[model samples]
Target: MALVPASARTWLWHEHAAVPLTDAPPVVTHLAWPPHSRSRPLAALVRTAARLAAPDTAPTP
Candidate 1:
């Protein structure tokens, strides 16, 4: 009844066995923030998340 990432299956196995939903549509995740915010910590977190999400084209190693 829930959709979870495959990577989390093992950790959640004890709670409930995961059944692959072969026909399920791919999940899309998104992030949002106030356009004019200038919080340094939030900016860093957003940058880190973007880098992790798209590693192949990340500017730095």
Candidate 2:
């Protein structure tokens, strides 16, 4: 498990070449929950897992 500070969310995508990190491309499927909420971290993990599961499908935007 990892902790992602809200401010560093954008940086995570840029620094990690392997992960799908793009605000415009909608890397995550569903992100209705507030980012500061506890569930936001889970959502991030889900997106990360999805990216890792299928790297080819994720666009590098």
Candidate 3:
């Protein structure tokens, strides 16, 4: 299974909204990862989950 959900792509898109990620609305983002990604750390994942779960406004970029 993908390490992160398909929606996880939105976090990255919010980071780079200046350019369009796809030719569509709702601003969807898609990503692919290895079955086992060693580069990502557990702590980072936890932090990212917390941020994503918490309420926030759209990115200002």
Candidate 4:
């Protein structure tokens, strides 16, 4: 299953999920960030990686 952070929900919901996977569609899990989060950018990057890693998905800018 692919895990995406909540900050990336907008892009993921609109663009990421349409791409097909080699296997089954991964169950997307949404992760939350705490207030004054230092990990927000990291979370977004991870989410981008998850999307890019899908066999049929294009690399997101």
Q: Pick the candidate with the highest TM-score.
A: 1
* Segments of candidate 4 deviating more than 4 angstroms: 1-38, 56-61
Clashes of 3: 0
Cα displacement (angstroms), candidate 4, residue 18, comes to 32
lDDT value for model 3? 0.49
Q: Native-vs-model 4 lDDT? A: 0.61
TM-score per model over all chains = 0.63, 0.27, 0.27, 0.27
lDDT of each: 0.78, 0.56, 0.49, 0.61
lDDT of 1 at 20: 82
By lDDT, the candidates rank as 1, 4, 2, 3
Tens digit per residue, CA lDDT, model 2, 6-44: 556666655453333456443345435556677766768
Ranking by TM-score: 1, 4, 2, 3
Error of 3 at 59 (Å): 20
Output the TM-score of candidate 1.
Answer: 0.63
Candidate 1 per-residue lDDT over residues 1-61, each given as its tens digit: 8887888887885769788879978765676889999999998987897777766655553
TM-score, structure 3 vs. true: 0.27
Model 3, range 10-56, lDDT digits (tens) per residue?
66655443343454455343334576766557546645655665266
Model 3, residue 20: distance off in Å is 15
Candidate no. 4 TM-score: 0.27
